[model samples]
Each structure stands twice: as structure tokens, then as C-alpha cells.
Target chain A: MKSHDSHPHYWKVFATFAKNSLIRDMTFRTNFILQCVSSVGWTLMNVGFYLILFQYTDTIGADTGWDRDKFFLFLATTWFINSIVQAFFMPNAEEFSELIRTGGLDFALLKPIDTQFLISFRKVDWSSLSNFAAGLVIAAISLWNLSARETNPMVPSIYEVALYIVFVFLGIVIMYSLMICLSATSVWLGRNQTLYNFWFYITNFSRYPMEMYNRGWGKPLYGFFTFVVPVLLVVNVPARILAKPIDPRTPSEWLLVGWAFVAACTSLLISRWVFYRALASYRSASS
Target chain B: MLTAPTWMNWKLSSWIMIFRTALEERLVYRGDFALGTLMRFLPIVTQIFLWFAIFDAIESKGENPKGLIGGFQFEEIVAYYLLTMLGRAFSSMPGLASGIAKQIREGEIKKYLIQPIDLIGFLLLNRIAHKFAYYVIATGPFALVFFLCRNFFINGMPDLLVISAFAISLLMGFLIGFFLEAAIGMIGFWFLEVSSLLFVYMLFSFFLSGHMFPLTLLPDQIEAVVNFLPFKYLAYFPAAIFLEKIPPEDLPLELAVEAAWLVFFIVVCRLAYGRGVKRYSGFGG
Candidate 1:
């Protein structure tokens, strides 16, 4: 059999998807503008709420050491990570279920390429770039504010920046795997849009720092989200790397990375297994 | 001029018809109605948990943090947020009015116009129908859960009266919101895109109306300015009434202001509809 990686058809499929996205976006200039405004407006609203909270209270978590700027930095990083996930993975998950419902998946499956890849990257929402950019601006502002307020003047080392990037990529992979796992369930369930939405809703908890839930009932719940669901690793670990330097002698940071890696791999394996299982049960709605 | 008795009877019967149709429609879509209600309440649940965590942390610090912050007890804050959430549910019906206006601009209003009813009345009825269903299924259960969890009570009969007054104010608030959205929606006839305008309006509602947080919690200068705006009538006033933060004597005057705003928006909506319909070239017909 021909190697799948060497196939020119894979590149052709990606090009077609990119071209279609460009065409669709060009047709709706007003939507693009509205989307950009919506992203910035939502970010401002969220930040405003946090600022109000911080104004009244000095500490959020068990640690009184971290201030408002650090909190804002955590939030901004989460927003950036979330926007990227929404831009890529969320659309794919949404489209996957929609395609299954509408029988659009038949056309995709018939194509001489990997059905998963074709379904996942069929269209990228260009407007999500606006959110990504807005998040970057907010993160920069937060970092500047933190620098001014920091009791301990510490600069992020090159290794820390590189590690942050790696963790962010891993977070995205984990999130994508989760989405695929959910979407794969749709092959049998047919139109599990509510389940998808519920997943998104649960993920909203990660927008704030995991430290906020460091104790009490919140601790156990946060642990589930971090270790089991692993959404917190998407933002919390990356932001922590930049904001607080952990000693390399300590094994905690390494353990977190290893856990994230395992979770990502497990989710991907489960997704593939679920997809095959659902495929076995699948009878075309049209037929 | 019409006789008072005859006019009153006609108005009463028309309202009855609208109510009956709305009730029936609500019954037809109970599942979706329940889901919509859940969606509305989810954010409140998340927020309450967050506040609970914050209060617990404060108490652990061996300081009266709650007392120090603006004389509000932790329970009072929860009550305030609950009232705010209820006001949000009631006042947000205006979004449908805007959706109707969009349909009108797109010439889809003709379909409704062909029916033996006023389009505005029909749209209003649709909104009330959904809200009625929501109230019966969603709001009732949500209120019960909140009250049970908080175990708080109104002080006296006077406070109960104030709560009643607040309910009336919320209805008025919804009408004002509806009319304002209708007026804005009519602008779709002039502008092909109104989402940005709608978003700006939503931003104003979220901030100035104190939907996200109480105006009192905001900076003093910003609070003073926002209080004068009609946005506060939609959310803050009703919430304050429920919290018994607003005195019973003030209820009548506050409701009167809300009624006046409703009337102003109604007139503006009527004028916009008149002009917008005349300019309708039926591009989407």
C-alpha cells in the first residue's frame, strides 16, 4: 500500500479547504467586522468583571502572594489559548456533528484521503484571528502591569518561553483530542449538538486561574478538570511558566508535562476507538 | 371617542387572546423551553459557586472581610445576584423583537402580515409565550433552588409588597427593552448590517444595566452616571427591590419612571415602523 504521508491528495484537500474559507469570509465583510468587535467586547467585559473583583479583594486563591496583575495575566493567557481552540478544534467538532446530521460526511468519506483530517480542517474561521490578536494585546497589557507591581523583579528565561510554547501546543492537542472524541460519538448518536455545547460550557471554568479553586470542594473539582479533563493545563501551566519560575530541581513541572502528554495520548486513542466503534453501528440515514 | 366600558372590554379580550395563544405555544415546545431555561441559569450557578469560594476564603483569614466591603453580608450579595439573574431573564425578551425587525427588513414580515393579526402583537405574543413557558418550568424551579439554598426571608408585609412592585417593574422593563430593540431593528431597513449596532446595545445593557455586577460595586463616579440611564430600570431597580434595598415608598415613583421610558420607546418604535415600512423595497421578498 502507498504511504499516506507521501500522498499529494492530502495537500490538495487542505488547499481546497483553505480556499473555501477565504471565499466564504470575503463574501461576509460585515460578519468579519462584527465578529472582531464581539471578541474585543467580550474580552473587555470579562476583564472589567475581574478588575471589579480585584478592586475589593487583594487575594483570589489560598496564596496571598499573587496580585491582580498576575490574575489578569492568567485570564488573558486562557483567553488566547481558548480563542485558538475555538478557531480550530471547536469548528471541527461543530462541523463534524453537523455533517453527520446533514449527510455531508458521505461526500467527505468518499474522498480519497483521511476522513478525520478532511473533516477536522475543512474550514477555519478567519475571524478567530481577531480574538487571538485581542488576547495578545490584553496579555501584553497584563504583563506590563504585573512588571510594575511585582515585589520580586524576575524576567522569564528563554527556556521558560520555549516550555510555555510547548505546553500551549500540547494543550491545543489535548483539547482537539477531546473534541474529536465527542464528535466521534456523533457517528452513532446522530446530532449530539447539546453534548458538544455542554462540553464547551464545562470548559468555561478554565478561563480563570486554577488557583482560585485551590481548596475546599473546588480543589477536588479542579483536580478532575486538570487531570481527568486536562483543560486547565491549556492555560494554567503555560501562564505559570511565564509568571512564576519553578526550580528545575523540583520534579512537579516535569510531572505536569508528563501527565498532560499521557492525557493527550489517551484522549486520542479513545477518540479513534470510539470512532471505529460508532462506524460499526453507522447505517447511512439516506440509505 | 370610544365608550370606556366597551374599549376596556375589547382591550381585555385582546390581551386574553394573546395570553392564550402564547400559553399554547409554550406548551408545544416544552423541551426546548426547558433547555433554554437551563442555559440561562448555568452562568448564575457558575457565578454563585465562585462567590461561595471567595467568601469561604475570606472567612478562613480570621477577618470580617464581608462586613468591611460595603456593608453587604455574603447572603445579601447572593440575594442581589439572584434578583439580578431573574431581572436578566425577564428583560432579555427584547432580543426576539430585534429578530422580528430583522425578518421585517428582509421582507419576511409579509408572511406574518398575511395572517389576521398585527405583526407587532404577534411578535410580542411569541416573546410572552416563550417567557411564560420559561417562567413556569425554568424560573420557578430556579427560584426554589436559590431560596432553599440561601434560606433568606423578607422582613415583613411591606417587603413583600415591594417584591410585588418589583415584579410589575420587571414587566415594564421587558416592554421598554422590547420597544427599544424594535426601534433599533427597524434601522435594518436603512442599514444592511445591524449586528454591530446590536452588539453595542448589548454592551451598554451588560455594563450600564448592572447585569454583570451591581452598580454600587462600580466606581462611585461611574455608578452616579449609570444610575440616571434607563438601563438601571431594567436590572438594578428590580434587583434592589427584591433585596429590600429599595424602600416601599419609592416603588411607585421608580415604576412610574419605567412606564414613562416604555411609553417613549413605544412611540419611537411606532414612528420607525411607519417610515421603515414605507421605504421597504422588498429586496428579500
Candidate 2:
């Protein structure tokens, strides 16, 4: 198999990967059931937290004119975006350092398909699909509640939804690239788990609306993290686009889009650079 | 059967051995140990700043909020959250149950069982040693930051006495939690998968323990129900003590309740261990 073949069918690779992952997951039915139950329990606990918070404070940021329903809808949307990332990106990122430790990357290197794509998409924890579905259902319910309460319902237009989807896709691409870059560092660090924890800790930024934070401090920091690193954009921008319609005339939305594109490009380039650099250090454990 | 004094001495020696092992193990991961401490500190700081921002916004709106959220002033809320943060740090025990489960699965615990050491004593010691270091390193800095950032004043020695009593309650709370976890770890002898059970316990601790939010913030009926639960003794009581909300005179009654729970958990652990050992096949061997 040619390692760098240009004519390789990527869809076929993905199909095989998906099928293998599904089979492996289905084999562990009891574990999957327990995980699903645990996910629902956690989601309910988290929602209860927000409900209690809103009980005391009517809006997260009252000055921003966001009410309880809007605040929760934003939280629900954030969870949805997070679930999407967890489903697609987190499993791969989590396994990277371990792969390096165990010399599992050699198998990927020997494959005809792109090593990066194979490593990132190889193991899909199908249980995360339940999380994603649950989050979307919760978001839909919250949005429905909001519409019922409002006299003139602020239902998001199709254009807004389309843009949001585009941003979410871009966000996932950037996130995957960032994970690849981070995982590539594992080749050098050699079994260090600190990076994974750091990634998880920083990802907590996406759990809430960025606007809830003081913008004076948050905006500049968000700009740096979102544009430069791109984790912040994963949920914040997508949630913003979905929660409210962006003014077409405003420079901010255009700047955000441009920034997201640049972030995606930069992440991919950096990941490629790191992966190639670390490839030299790869020594198989089998030897 | 061993005499009481001999058993006590044996337990003490085993505890020292466990502590020594943990310390050595912790030293091997010094960098991560430091980072974990810092990571643990960040959540508390973030929570404090978040509450500060909210209360600042509220006070600026010219409400004389004096009690708790529109009752007490913003300073009180800061103090409450700071104490809660400190309580959270002190109360958190490492999930050694899962670690033990893994050991059991891998046949690692069988070697330990052959040794003269008391397994429960060793496990509890390991927990206490790490917690001792963590509370001092993490909560010490947190308390310092909190005090430095605010003009906190105590009304009297009675409040200080209440806080001290709450500290004892906090210790008992940790004991209850540790024994409960030990009991759960023993369940590994029967069940191959206990992660879900552990997750349920964690969620219960986070919500019902008043770790994420104040117990008083819940509706009166809910607060009454929560008060009857053991989770409140873990965090809420300590926080109430620091805020001077719990009256100094009521300290003994609360301490008795905490002690009762500790005793109950100890009995449960003993029962679980007895039954668990009968079912224990030492599978890998």
C-alpha cells in the first residue's frame, strides 16, 4: 500500500472505521447502557444547577437583556456543541498520548490512508451519540419554552441556522486540528497526561456563554484563545450565531468568520508540522 | 483474636507504611502533583470571582443586600463562597475505590491481602495522607487569598468556637465519605464494572452536598429535606460555621449527627468487607 497515494477513497476509509467502531461498541452492550444512564444523570444534575442559579438571579447577565430561558437555552446549546466535539474529536485526542506510549502510531504509519485522518477518526465511542442526542433534545425543549413565553417569538431564521451550522463545522475542523497538534506533542512528552487534563480544563470555557464573563477581561482573552488557539470558538461563536441573529452590516460577525477560517488553517498547518516533526522520534515498541 | 492494644499498634504501623508509600509515589509525579494543585485552585478562584462579579453588580444597583442574596451584603456572600471553597477542598477524597477495583481486577490486591497490614487501615491512611497535603497546599492558599481580598470580620469568640467545632465536623465528614468509598471498593469483588456506581456517588456528592451551590438557596422545603440527608454535613455545615450562620450553641448537636453518620458508615464498611471476602475468588490467581 502506497503511504502517500492521492487516489485513496477517503469515504471508504471512514465507512470501514465507522463499521468497526460500531461493532466494537455493540459488543459492550452493558457498558454502553450504563454510560448512557450516567450521561443522562449528569445532564439532569447540570440542568438542575442552572435552574437553581436562575431561581435566585433572573438572568445570567441582566444588563445584556438575557432572561432565564435565554440563559438556559445558551447553556443547552453549549452542551450540544460540546457533545458534538466529544463525539467526534475527544476520543481521538484522549487516545493520542497513550498511542505514542504503546507505539500504536506505527500501525497508522503503515496504513495506505492518511495517518492523521486514521488516528483521529479510528475509534468512535458510539455512546457519545446518546449525549449529543440528549443535548439537542434538551436544547429543543428549552427553545420551545422560550417561544411559548415570548409574544413575538424570536425563532432563528433559516439563514441564521445555516450560518451556525457552517460555523459549527468550521469549529469542529479547527478543534480536530488543535487536538492533532496537541496529540502530536505526545510523541515528544512520552506518556505525559498533563496535556490532556489541561485541554479538558480549558475546554470548560465553552460550557457557558462568553458574554456572562466580564467582556473587558473576557473579550481580549477570548479573542486570543478563540482566534489564536480556537477552543473558545467551538461553542461560543456557534451558540452566539444560533441564539441571536448577527447583523449583516456589523463588522464583528465578518471579523469572527474570518478569524475562524484563519484559526482552522493555522491549526491544520501547525498539526501537520508537529506530526512530521514527531514522526522522526517514532520508534516502534515491538522492536 | 488479637488484643485491642496489639491491633491498634498494628493498625498504626500499617498506616505509617501506607503514608510513606503514598509520599514516595507522589514524589515521582512532582510536576503533575503541582499542576493538579494549581488546577484544583482554579475552580475555586473562578467561582469566587463569578460570585464577586454578581454581588458587585447587585450592590451597585443600590440594594442594601445584607443577609444572603439580597438579605446579607455582598461581603457575606464572598465569605460564604470562600468557606465553601475551603470546605470542598478539605472534604474531597481521592477516588481510591476505583483504583482498588482496578487492582482487584489485575490481581494486585491479592499480594496486599497476604501482608500483615490491615487493608482498610492502609487505604484510609493513603486517603488521609494525600488529603492532608492537598488541604494544606490548596486550601491554605485559598484561605489566604480570600482573607487578603476582603475585609472579613468576626463578631465574637463564639463564632470562632463554632468554626472550630465545624472543623471537627468536617473531619468526621471525610471519614464517612472514605468508609462509604471503601465499602464500594469492596463491591468490586462481585462486580466487574463499578464506574457507573461511582459516577452516581460523585453526582450525589456534587449536588446534594451543597458543593456547587448553597443549601440555603434551595426552597425551604427542599432545604429541610436536604438537611436530613448526610450530604449537607459534608459541605454546608462547614460553610455555615465559617459564615457564622450556624449558632455557636448548636455546635454539639451537629457534631453528634456527624459522629452518628461516621459510626454508621464504619459498620456498613465492616459488613461489606465480610461478605465481599466470601465472594472474593482472587480471580487472576
Candidate 3:
């Protein structure tokens, strides 16, 4: 019954949700452990894949400036951002349409708390967060190796590290915005079976650096993802800020940082608008 | 319900009927199928960029490199990916295993027990029909993408032998993939939750089966290990056979090995289903 307008009440409710989620996870001890192990194993396999590719080439793309360690750092950031999104938001988006079809959202709407917050954080998939720990380990190792290297060392100052954290959070915000917007579409469609598949197809582009998308034919693709969908800014900016900080030597490079900030704000606003509009159009299912 | 026919001719006729019904079910949402298939091809865009950069880097070196890296010429690599798309079309079971596990968990599998049709055979025929429907509906998208990649066929059309080998491998790969997944789903008879297990199996299969990149790109020792594994028959072997990357002497042996794996998985699937069905309790009812 407590509203989310008050900051203290929101945090209190969130803490309870986290605690309940942890309890549920612990109730299935073996399943929890196996899920964690499986996730970590998958990450290790991905690392091995990149290691083999690095043997054949010095960088992911020609003259892209992303070397092995830096690229791993980028990959680690991807896992971290994606883990958070998946752990909290993905399951909820996947189930949103079911709630609508079954009239479960009516109960949610009756609650005094903010509807979006309740829907998004209601189910925390604790096992999905297992990849977050692996991401941290990979990020640490990549950072250590990058600093040890002779060529273009990338040791971040404390200020830069703080900026990195901020940008990473911004990246999560952008991704969450995208997800909720798609979930909102479930209201009109009545079913969103293809939402996750479409999401995966789109986000696959974010796995690689944006610079890789700047070639001849890639130019249009680069423009589309950067300006149209804006997924290109989600991971690349935060990864670059941490792994290979942009030099102030070029005005164009500075524009990229500015674009990241703009992207984050625009995505958040658009998603919020879409969610509310979808809710407004909702006609509760008959009992 | 009608009993299955004893005659060999009628047995084939019933399977054809099953296949046709399944194909009709898939075609019910033809637009969805076409759009979904096209969206999945979006990754090809990323691959083209990634490969182009790799080739550019290789070209930057002083040597001509003969259009080759990792035993695949640049055009050949693109051709290989196009072939892989076709191979995966046959072999990839997106949610088949999980769907089976869900049915077993929910006790819906009892319908299969009561039905006259063999569960494995029914599922296999249904999947064959689904793939047939997908292939027919998606041929336009496939052709469009392949047309873009036409230049990648540097050697023109391959010989009949290569094409035959490739087709055989893809068919065997589909059988292997199906049986392997159905066997995994049968694990649900013992463990109520096969989701995590399926996750592990899928993750390993995706990497080892050369879905992400060719196994040949791995180191020689690792590639040898992968070759010994059954996963390559699912994606890599068909593509390799089509490209004539496998030596002429090796073709028969590789195909034989692929067929052996198919038989192995078929046996495993039957054994698992046989044992699991006996222990399956109707939980919901």
C-alpha cells in the first residue's frame, strides 16, 4: 500500500524484494548452484573463443584500436550490463503479456506503489546474476593485464573509474528503457512471443564495438544503430571510457561522449512515455 | 482412436499424414514464420562486417595471403557462413527439448503414452514437417541473402558429389540433433528440473558445434578434439563438405562417422524414452 514517491519507502520495499528473491533461490540449493556453475562455464567458453581468435588477428577489426585485453574488457562490460538487465528485467518483460492476458495486471494496478517499478522488479532471477560475478573477475584480469602491457597502457585514474561506473549504470538504464518499451507493446498485441527473440537479434549488434560498424556498407548500419535504435552507444561508450579512454585530441571523439549522455536521456524518456501510454489504453480483462 | 496399420505401406502412409498435418500447423502463421526467419538473419550483417575487418587486417600484411585465412578464402568464408545458415535451418531445435521437458513435468506427456504413435517417431516426423514448411516459406529470404553472398562462391557451383555429400550430412545432422535433444529431455523423468541441464548442454553444443565460428579456426589440437566429438556433424561438417574443404578421400569416412553418430543418438533416444516412459507418473491428473 506504500507509494514509491517517498524515497525511503521505495528502498524499503526493494530490500524486501531482494530478500525474498534470495530466500527463494536458497530453497532450491542444488538448482541454484548448478545454474551458477553453468553460467560461469559458458562465460569461460566465450573467453576461450576470443582467445583463439586473438591468435589469428591482433585486433577484432582492422585499425579499430580494440586489442585483445581491451576487447575482453568490453566483453566483460557487456556481460555485466546484460546480467543486470536479464536478472531483473528480462523475465518480467517475458511474462508481461501473460499478466495482461490473465488479468494479473489488475491486482498490480490496484497497489499504491508505482506500477512500472513493481512490474519490473517483482521477479528477480538470482541465478541469472551469476554471470555478473564472472564479469567482475574478467574485468579485473583484463585491467591488470592491460596495465602490465607496454603498448598504450590503460590504467584508469579514480575519477575515470567513477565515470566508468556512472556510464555503466547509464548503459543499464538505456537497456532497461529498450526492454520496457518492447514489453509495453505486449498490451496491444495481447501476446509477445517474439519479443525476446527480436531483442536478442537487435542486441547482437551491441556485442561488437561500434567502430566495427563504420566500414563502407557498415556506414548505414552504423548510422541506423547509433541514431535510430541507439543500442550502439549502450556498451561501447562505457567500455571505451574504462578500457581505452577517449583522448580530448579530437572534437569528434568528444561528440561521442555527448551523444552517449543524450542517448541515455532520450531512451529513458521515450520508454516512460510508452509505458504510461500503454497503461492508459489498457482495458482490464473480464473476470 | 484408430490403430496403426500393420502393413509397411500403410505405416509409411500414416507418417506422411503426420508430416502433412504438422506442416499445415506451421503454415497457419506463414507471415510470422517469414518475418521471424528474416529477423534472425540480422546477424549476417554483423558477421559480414566482422569478416571484412579480419580480411582487411590480413590484407594489411605485406603478403597477398591468396584470399585465404584459416584454410578458407575470403569469399569461401562467406560461402561457408551461407551454407551454415542452411545447415542450422535443419539442425537447430530452438525449444524442442524444453518443450518436451515441460510436457513431461505437466503430465501432458501422458497423451503420447495413450496415443498409438511412438512418441519419438511422432516428434521426429512433426519436426521434419516443420522444417519442410520453414524451408518452403523461407526460401525467398534465404535466396535474397544468398544472392547478396553470390560473389562468395568463387569456384561457382560445386560438383554433384559435393552437393550430395552436403545434403546427406544435413539430413543426418537433423536426425542427430533431434535425437540428442529428445534424449536430454528424457532426463526429466528423473530430475523434475532439466532447464539448467538443458542450458548447459545448449551452451556447450553451440560452441562445439561450430555455430559461432568454424572449428577449424581453433588450434590444431583443439580442432582434432572437436572432430572426434559428434557436434561438428550438426553444422560444420555439412558446410565443410559443400566447400570441398574435406579432401576427396576423407569425404566417405566423414559421412560414415556422421551416420554412426546419428545411429548412436537414435539408440540413446530410444533407450532413454523407453525407460522414462515406464517411470512417468501422471502428476497433474
lDDT on C-alpha atoms for all candidate structures:
0.72, 0.70, 0.85
DockQ in order: 0.38, 0.45, 0.66
Q: Which whole-number lDDT from 0 to 100 does residue A135 have in model 2?
A: 73
How many residue pairs clash in all the candidates, one count each? Answer: 0, 7, 0
| Candidate 2 lDDT over residue span A1-287, tens digit each | 35454767878878887889889878988888888888888888888877776665654543543456666666766666667677767888778777788887777788877777777777777777777777777778867875787454667779978987887777777767777777778777776577777777666665655545545545665666665677767766666676653323357756776777777777778888787777777877776
Per-residue lDDT of model 1, residues B97-197, tens digit only:
45865686567877755665566676677777777777888865676667664643334223458768877978887887777777788888788667777
Q: Candidate 1: deviation at residue A209, Å? A: 2.0
- Which stretches of candidate 2 lie above 4 Å from their native place? A1-6, A215-220, A245-254, A280-287, B1-15, B45-82, B103-116, B133-159, B281-285
After best superposition, candidate 1 residue B190: deviation in angstroms?
A: 2.0
Clashes of 3: 0
Q: What is the Cα-based TM-score of model 3?
A: 0.93
Q: Interface root mean square deviation for model 2, in Å? A: 2.3
Candidate 1 lDDT over residue span A132-183, tens digit each: 8877887788677666654655566799779878877777777787788788
Expressed as tens digits, the lDDT of each residue in B18-111 for candidate 2 is 7988766655655566666566545544454456555544544455354246233456655666666667666666677898788777778777
TM-score of each: 0.88, 0.88, 0.93
**DockQ, candidate 2, vs. native dimer:** 0.45
